[model samples]
Target chain A: MAKSKSRTEAPQDASEDVVMQELPTSHQPDVQDDASMAEVDAEDDAEVEDEEEIEDDTQRVRLLPGSTPTAASFEFLNEGHTLGNALRYIIMKNPDVEFCAYAIPHPSEPKMNVRIQTYEGTTAIEALQKGLKDLQDVCDVVSDKFVAAQKDFKKKSISS
Target chain B: MDYDPMAMDEIESKGPVIKISQADTVRVKFELSNADISFANSLRRVMLAEIPTIAIDLVEIEDNSSVLADEFIAHRLGLIPLNAEGIEELQYSRDCDCEEYCDHCSVKLTLHARCTGDENMQVVARDLVPSGDRINRVLGTPIINESSDGLGPLIMKLRPGQEIKLQCIAKKGIAKEHAKWAAPSAIGFEYDPHNKLHHLDMWYETDAKLEWPPSEYADWEEPPQEGERFDFNAVPDRFYFNVETAGNIPPDAIVTEGIKVIQQKLASMIHDLGETEGGENGDYNGPRSPEYNGGGDGWQDQGFTTPYGNGGNQSAWGGGAGGTTPYGTTPYGGAGAGNGGW
Candidate 1:
């Protein structure tokens, strides 16, 4: 039965291979036509490129099933030096995204608040989970230094 | 002491509210009563003061209490928010002994004279004159006789940046400076600051599921202003917004495409879960539908075992937990026409 099955598959696979191999080579004349039709085809190619990117992303996503993704944000609240540093980091990391931002002057506070928006697409629930995990990792790496900085900012404000 | 121009009892027949639409024309209104003639003359001098207001287009408010309004008032009070450094440099040389004024000092003069007299001002620099010579001298002082009871008029001149330091001259009933002069010099509307966050609010409104702020009403009501166009393409599905300011979190940032890919994978898994739940028959236990091989004859209910052929395993394609293969023997198709006779 297995021999018969292999024999049945062999003839069918051979025909498919022949068809696949000859189709492109047989269309050699079409290549010149493709060149002549380049401008219109270029637009088609761009759309195809976009689809290919999405397809690649879909394949990658399928491999990591059930994994949550999160967004990493950098806030610039009053500390110009830290903000400049954070902005530099973002620019370095996400060169493709156009960053839109503006400053809001705090009524009594001595400094301005700079708000920035970055575009990313991951569901909020997944993003939240990832964000929490990232926060944990950040906290661990700093060895509670992050907490200490917050306390310092608070103390400075209160003391002043 | 200038009379309050905004005071209510002042008008005999209120003058038409002269609305100035032309950008070039300077509009000055004297809300003076028929009795207050001297105050009207004081306004002309204040208008001539050389303070300039700088216009900046801002997006958000740091202070909503209208400090800009106060700045305007202070302008009327003769205080000006200095323009850039160049103008400040110019103020130092408006009045000087040199034919071409130099930085030692310039005398800025604002004269509010209604009583009809010429007041020549002398501002002597320390370098040009000795210690006793440094003085702010009013050349001609006008004196009204006793029974007239009315201050014949008022006069005050000022240097740029210097406040108009003139008191209201008034008799028992006749008040002039107080009735016609503005308390603060208001810079034109160009310098008025606006909110920036409204830009985001408009973006949200373009596709928002939730309501934006109250200011959005005015924005929606008005036509599009320059540099302000709504971004209609930013869809809710394509973005995830968070209130980073509310918590001690990072500000708005977009995750990378890899993160979205992970999200799509998870979504697919959920879809698969639904499909598996739907495909599962009532065995209630065992590997799920995608893995379950229920007595495969393709017609196991009809009492045949091994759907593919003799001695073949009941599992389709015979692998443990392999993903569903598309060309598996469909349970609906009969093996042969003679096998299942309805």
Candidate 2:
């Protein structure tokens, strides 16, 4: 089963790589070298503007164009399977979501792309928001229970 | 929201439950029930790599006459867990406003040991004195036999006339950057002990049970019958976790901190998404225009709309386009299957 799954997945991975490679050049060109040299002249004027633009350019999440309400792909910066897998699991649990999956464009780059396909009634964004909210709720409960358990254990040890 | 007793009861029963079987300053064993494997795995991974702790990140040696090399002693010092009680208030050095390091970002520790007498002297974690009152070595409990004097982990030994003097800068960091910053020494996670879910394949010549004995945790669930029909569709919902800390932070606190880290990550992602939602036409083209163009023309034009989208998808990647030619299949479809259908 695993072997056949990999075979079917091989071609798809190749295409995603193409997207990853083309993304950088289109957004921010070779402006860093020019910006650094310009910094010595103005010091604060153009340098601050360049820094702001760079910050805006590196926004953590971006919605890919051509995304419909029901189906969409989102690119996440500086994220990996740690958030991706958990979010996928939570999103898949919602009955409105038809499919949910996440992939890392490349190992070297800390980026994750998540695709969510929802049923007709619900939008992909809504499903994603719900997934994030649900995951947060789960963590809240886990933390609370753990803290309470620890306190109980400590009290038991002290009394005994 | 309307209060429905039946709905409330169902939600309460389905919510995750955590039961701590054993807990101490250095170790904890717990069972997380009513949760999926992915959620449990995330928590475990975060604990191992994301939850921050204080460790000696920089060392400036002024004198060294000990047998160990300077780098070796520095490495050892980095592994020693310091008290991380107020770590939440401490800022990462990179984020701090100070030039290099300050009290807000780091704590200074100095160790000056010399053996002038005939006998050899032992330099341990306890010997490193902290400049701040809040930071110190996490003394091991005598009950665990960690040490007779509770001096902490040994760094090195100095012979007569041998001396070692060094200044260490302990800073907050996560294990993802360096192993020394990890709070847990070990974390064990196990699920589906009977292997009824077929998550693991047992290899045995004659008897599978003999070759692959059930783990101790298997007792928590009933054993499969000799000729019982297995539920192939059953998913493992219960997870057993054993967390052993390195004494910098309490074991129970580590689990909570890990969960909080996951929560923070999700919250941050949600916040970012909300910020992009305000963009025109519901399209986010902030700095990721290249991604937008690549994904739009590259993915959509190739019928890489959805992983399991309907046919006619073949035409999208049917061929003429040079961009699509590099990646023949639908991009998102490949993304879904490539990530092992996560």
Candidate 3:
């Protein structure tokens, strides 16, 4: 994937996004990028995150393979939360994850694909549900802190 | 965890989904019936560390007249992942009985450079020549095929007043011993199955009574029966797989090679088990290929010792250059010099 560096950067600055960033992995990425390494092998795997299908409020999860509790896909339509990155980060947190990765299949589709891989007894769907719920818990804590910060700012303004 | 992988039959299962983005990288999604996390974990672990490939383990620097230190050049040379085709034809040095080197064990590469003219010049990987007849320098891409994109990374630089000569020995080994011989730059699989959509809203934004798998993913021949979509909307147990190469080997070759290694290891284990159990139960008829001894230590020793080849040898043609003789014997040996840099 010809991922431009600028594409992976946070969208705070328009022109600041110029470098593609690699997804974090269990091993250090430095040794892999040897200076003498042939450039052909340096093709970046990252992609420009699609910011279209993002809705900050809506969250959806669809069970795949019909009724089986084996697999599931979580799609965020309008929330530009970068859930794939978050979910992949969560998967990495689990040393037992069979497989985990994020994909933005088509350039026209703004949806992120967060797939969970499990085997034997633990179904991927269960792991996915757990991850989503855990993420929500983290978000709730962040939301509370934001509200507290707002109240503090308001009090400071009244005193001034 | 309770299921035995060996007992499981290859059911009439669906094919794996494959998506190749570049020549060096590929993504695959497939299902494993009657298999568990243990099996998947083993495959991933073996592919990363057990699968064998060629690497420059030892370097002989006869003369170093360049600005860079001797170890620096040697380290850089070891890092270049050679084109690993026909790797199955080679043998791990530990398994080979040759004292110094042998055709079946190691391939020799020589780099002899000197500044001929008064003008300033540079030396590159194009100067290092692998005994072409004995070893393949990976096909479809040359060692120093520098393009506009600079996909061809440089090996070393030389000056007009400098001169250098050394012999490099390439041997078969796994990533556990050193990263130079690692199978893939990146490899991991996830569960991704062909999911079927129940209703209209469960799929795309279309209202029409769509067919199973809809139309975008209509590659499947036989669509699901009426009232049942292929669950094209949700795939269970199916996973996304990715594998990248370090330019020496293609992504597909590395994947196939990795699988081959895993199969061999499993087959050996099964054979060893059958041999020991058959003696007690009578009539053991499992395919016996990689023979194992009657004790636990033999198996464990085989598992640990042979994987890493003999390292730390800097002999200057002293018990070294095991397969160097094959170079002159091959018709292409002399011709290899004309192929790379002058």
Task: List native contact recovery per candidate, as a fraction of 1.
Answer: 0.00, 0.46, 0.00
Between candidates 2 and 3, the one scoring higher on DockQ is 2
| Cα-based lDDT for every prediction | 0.26, 0.74, 0.48
Task: Tell me, by DockQ, which candidate is best.
Answer: 2
What order do candidates take by lDDT, descending? 2, 3, 1
**Model 3 bad stretches (over 4 Å):** A1-160, B1-37, B116-120, B132-142, B145-152, B188-236, B278-342
Please, what are the lDDT tens digits per residue for candidate 2 over residues B26-112?
A: 789999888877888999999999998888889999999999999999998887777777788888998787999988888888999
Most TM-score-accurate candidate:
2
Q: Which ten residues in a row have the lowest lDDT in candidate 1 chain B?
A: B246-255
TM-score of each: 0.17, 0.78, 0.42
**What does candidate 1's lDDT look like per residue over B1-342, in tens digits?**
122222212333332121111111122211112211112222222222212211111112122132234344233322111112122222222233456332233222222212222443221111111112112231111222233343322222323333222221111100112321121233221100123323232456454434444432233223346888655532111011111111111111011111222233334434433432342243321122122243332332221112222112322232433212322335754433323321
Candidate 2 vs candidate 3: the TM-score winner is 2
The DockQ-based CAPRI class assigned to model 3 is incorrect
| Superposed Cα RMSD, model 1 | 33.3
Clashes of each: 21, 1, 34
Order candidates by DockQ, high to low. 2, 1, 3
Please give the C-alpha DockQ score of model 3: 0.01
